[model samples]
Target: MGIIWSVIFSGMSFYWAMGGRLGVRSLGGALYEMSLNPSPSFLAIVWLTGFIKLLGAALLIMLLVHRHNSKLDRKLFYTVKIAGAFLFLYGALNFITISLHAFNIVNYNLDHYATFWRLAFWEPYWMAGGIIYFLSAKRT
Candidate 1:
């Protein structure tokens, strides 16, 4: 169970790293394209979010690589578990946003089936993995 939790956390960390990289790239491009008139607040938010994702990924990797025989490893596992819980909660919120957007339930423009597909199928597995990692890490 510990190994399984470690693997799941590691995998999620990798996924989040890649997602953060892509988001930074794409959002940067979009901000640039907006008449080169990027909002300072928007850019700041993007940078902050990207950094958090990168940091989370690094912490997860550190936790995964550290040997469990040490006290430090246990501490790292606790940190990873907290981070995993945050990630899963954030993912759940994202799914809720998607559902709201897709159903025209939010103030923004509806995305029709695009958001629906994401909320209905894709995000659950990631959320589940995070939950499993959190539970297993607690036991460890």
Candidate 2:
């Protein structure tokens, strides 16, 4: 289940990394209609982050599979735990910020919400891997 969810998230991250339009709208109330014509630097950062996230998700799946096959591989288990924790943190931070921006919980510029929809959509799965990893830790 974790691997499946991670793979799905990796696909979404890949799409975002390729400058796809999944994150081009707001997910909160009041249809936000702002120009997405951001500076090149901003776009570059977004793409870079997306790519890194995609890679991380892929690595997560690989690590989990390895751990599954080698129950005695303590090192791989730790790696999975750490990686999952970090992924959880990353997604949690993004989720909080996006939710705040969209729901007007914080006074952030609405334009920033363009990427909110994409991240918000993957929030559940983003943390699912982490939770799975943590739970697996107790088993072996």
Candidate 3:
């Protein structure tokens, strides 16, 4: 059970890292377009956010790997569970951020309904799986 949760956690970390990479590329393009009349503060914030995201994803992957290797220990198991919960929370935040961006509530509209629904629904399913795996591993 611990091994299973570790795998799930690792998979999610990898998925998030890939997503972050794509976001960085897209945002870089957008930033380039805005550079003609650039806001230095805005550009700084974008770069900072990208760095944090990439670092967090890397940390998550490392945590998952460590957890997988130490699955026999209760402390490591709990650590994985906590990390999974954090990932799910991050997913929820990402959903909200995308929605805000798409709706033009904060930034210009960048998301369509199709992409919104895919992230809002499909992404949460994996989060739920991660939570379930954590809970079941506790039972074992």
Give all candidates' CA lDDT scores. Answer: 0.54, 0.57, 0.50
User: Which residue pairs show collisions in model 2?
Assistant: none
Compared with the true structure, model 2 gives a TM-score of: 0.54
Task: For each candidate, give its TM-score against the true structure.
Answer: 0.50, 0.54, 0.42
Ranking by lDDT: 2, 1, 3
RMSD of each: 6.6, 5.5, 8.1
1 or 2: which has the higher TM-score? 2
Per residue, candidate 2 scores C-alpha lDDT tens digits across 42-98 of 556656656665665555555545445564566656766787797678778867876
Q: Can you rank all candidates by TM-score, best first?
A: 2, 1, 3
Model 1 Cα RMSD, Å? 6.6
By summed lDDT, which 10 consecutive residues of candidate 3 come out lowest? 20-29
In model 3, pairs of residues that clash are none
- Superposed by TM-score, candidate 2 places the C-alpha of residue 23 at a distance from the truth, in angstroms, of 4.1
Candidate 1 regions exceeding 4 Å error are 1-37, 67-69, 100-110, 117-140
**Which stretches of candidate 3 lie above 4 Å from their native place?**
1-72
Clashes of each: 0, 0, 0
